[model samples]
Target: MCTYLKNMANYKHSHLKNKSFEEIQMLFNNTLKWIESFVPMDTELVKGSEKVAKGCSKRATYKLEQEDAKRQRIEEENESVE
Candidate 1:
């Protein structure tokens, strides 16, 4: 009886292993199809994000330039006083 139960357990384990592999393959194929359907939208999203990043960088650069000019003006006024 114990041998029979052990064999049954082993059989179930083997069956489960086979099923898992098939499930994984199915999931991968489905994901590929989904990505293919939305490829254009994904590209647009990536481009939009890049544009936003560039705009932020430009704004930061402009702010730094204004700050540097203000500092130079202050230094010039101080030198004239001396």
Candidate 2:
């Protein structure tokens, strides 16, 4: 009788473990769908942010180049005076 009960318990545990994989998958899909409903994947937001980042990078590059050019001009003028 004890052996039978142990076998039954083992069977139940195995069945539960099998069901858990499917349950976890269903939970993940449901969660993703719920989140998507609220957030609704915006391509424009990504593109806009990328454009803003590129603009900022270009502006920084231009500022650095201008500063370098100014410094080179000053050094050249000082060299000529010397």
Candidate 3:
């Protein structure tokens, strides 16, 4: 379980590199929680559960990015600190 979560966190960090560090971290954590709540507990393998996983990741990402519209502008303008 630890390894799985670690890998997911790493993937989230890399996948959402465009996002701020804090936002990615929060989203990554929330993703793990979402999996726990939405995924079936009977199995560890994520086979055939791609939709749930993707939905969770998208939701987490969307939640963070939506709240920080100015952050996107700052990043696009190559400014550091928002």
Candidate 4:
């Protein structure tokens, strides 16, 4: 199917080289209709996709503070050496 679309696109580009933008858009939309004929329409909204934990924000802030403290310590040590 992907190969077919690629070949069709090449064919369209070769044949419609002189066509206007509107004509090209219409041809592209018509080509997409073939995909719709093969694939079923997904109308339902996806539910319950909770990716983050409850304390994720707190943990992230703590991690950022730890990294900042480490960076500050490194800078302080470098300044003392100089």
Each model's TM-score, in the order given? 0.49, 0.48, 0.29, 0.36
TM-score of 2: 0.48
Provide the lDDT at 30 for model 3. 86
Q: Which stretches of candidate 3 lie over 4 Å from their true place?
A: 1-15, 39-82
Better of 1 and 3 by lDDT: 3
Q: In terms of lDDT, which candidate is strongest? A: 3
Clash pairs (backbone) in predicted model 4: none
Give model 1 RMSD, 1 decimal.
12.3
* Tens-place lDDT digits, model 3, residues 9-72: 4564345647676866677678778877785645656664776889999999998888698778
Q: lDDT of all the models against the reference?
A: 0.66, 0.65, 0.68, 0.66
Best by TM-score: 1
Residue-pair clash count for candidate 2 = 0
